[model samples]
Target chain A: QQQVKQSPQSLIVQKGGISIINCAYENTAFDYFPWYQQFPGKGPALLIAIRPDVSEKKEGRFTISFNKSAKQFSLHIMDSQPGDSATYFCAASRTFGNEKLTFGTGTRLTIIP
Target chain B: DTAVSQTPKYLVTQMGNDKSIKCEQNLGHDTMYWYKQDSKKFLKIMFSYNNKELIINETVPNRFSPKSPDKAHLNLHINSLELGDSAVYFCASSRGLAGVRQETQYFGPGTRLLVL
Candidate 1:
């Protein structure tokens, strides 16, 4: 079973536009939600993360809006640039236990100038 | 310095051949993990080791085995490689123990394996 589900397998946005990707989770035990960005031929890197306690988190132009009640979260990139063109993955994991991450399928984001 | 590194950035082998991929971390982390990203870019955890001890072993095949020589090194050995095994394998490490919450995981550049 896919504990974490992501929508829009691919996305395209013009430069300076807002790019959004959404993800939903089925496990309520998940407390840590993180987003990873990966470029071609490289491994995924941590972009931003949020906890259940926070409704939203902003790091520069990147923002993560989390809704614990709905078991959903979304990533918003303001002023999306060509440099931001990469694959984005949303992951969830519990604070305790094995703490293994459950990742979404992934979304390939393209920023066109 | 590279936080995490893997050997043979690209591996092309024939089916039924046995192959291995090595991973090492220099971030003084105690936990290491192996994740496979398929063609569709779906990333899944295969195994995890904490302090040279096995912790998380997902529903992977027996042909795939993970050995941790020490907290800094984790190696993956695959027997009888198949075409389905063609994907990019990533190694990651975190600071805390397996049971503890370590949110940040540093990943390697990834080893792209192609089984012909």
Candidate 2:
């Protein structure tokens, strides 16, 4: 079963526009939610992360809005640029010592100038 | 310097052959992970090691084996390779185990394997 589900397998946005990707989870045990960005031929890197206690967290132009009650979260990129074109993955995990991250099906984001 | 490094960035082999991929981290992390990403871009955990000890082992095939010579190195050995095993493999490391205050993971450039 897919514990975490992401929507819009692909996305396109003009430069300086806002880009958004959404994800939903079924496991209530999940407490940590993180977003990763990957460029072609490279490994995925950490972009932003949020906990269930926070409604939102922002880092630079990247923001993560999390709703614990709805078991949903979304990533918003303000002023999206051509450099922002990459694949994004949303993941969830419990706060255990050795928990493995459960990842959502990824979204390919494209920022056109 | 790369934080995490994987050798043999690309591998191509015929079916029934055996191969191994090596991973190393210089960040002095205590945990390492192996993930497989399919053509559809779905990533799944295959194994995890913490302090050179196996911690998470997912429902992967028996043909796959993970060896941790030390905390900084983890190797994957595949036997009797099959066409279905063709995919990109990623190695990652963290300062501590997953879910420990949401430790950020550092990933190495993936290894693309093609089995015919």
Candidate 3:
């Protein structure tokens, strides 16, 4: 069973527009939620992360809005640029200090100029 | 300098052949992980090691084996390669586990394997 589920397998947005990706998780034990970005050939890099205690966290133009009761989280990109075209993955992990992370299916986002 | 590095960026071999991939991390991390990204771009965890010890092993095939000689290095070896095993494999390391302040994982470029 997939612990985390992401919606919109692919997305396209115009430059200067807002891009959003949604993710939902089934496990309530998950406390840490993180987002990763990957280009064509490189590895997935950390974009932004948020804990269950916070409703939202923002870093630069990237923002993660988390809803604890709903067991959902979403990533928002403000001022989407063409360079932002890439795959994004949302992951969830428990507080057991285990390095095992349950990753979502992934969302391919493209920003058209 | 690369925080995590993997050897043999690409591998192509016959179905019955065996191959090994090496991974190393210079970030002085205590945990290492192996993730397989399939054609549909689903990143799945295959194995994880902490402090030179096996921590987590997912529902993978028995033909796959992971070895950690030390905390800085992790290697994966596949025996009797199958066509279904063709995918991109990634290596990652983290100072500590998630749910902590320093739980971010650094991933290597990745190794693309194609089995015929």
RMSD of model 2 against the true structure: 1.2
Candidate 2: true interface contacts recovered = 0.78
- Greater TM-score among 1 and 3 belongs to 1
Docking class of 3: medium
Clashes of 2: 0
lDDT of 3 by residue, A3-113 (tens): 899989999999999999999999887888999999999999999999888899999999999999999999999999999999999999875577478999999999998
lDDT of 2 by residue, B11-72 (tens): 99999999999999999999999999999999999999999999989999999999999999
Model 1 CA lDDT for position B105: 89
Ten consecutive residues with minimal summed lDDT in candidate 3 chain B? B95-104
Candidate 3 chain A, run of 10 with poorest lDDT: A92-101
| DockQ of each candidate relative to the true complex | 0.75, 0.69, 0.61
Model 1, residue B27: C-alpha shift (Å) = 0.3
Residue A98 error, candidate 3, Å? 1.0
Question: For candidate 2, lDDT tens digit of each residue in A12-111?
Answer: 9999999999999998888989999999999999999998888999999999999988999999999999999999999998766788889999999999
C-alpha lDDT of residue B93 in model 1: 91
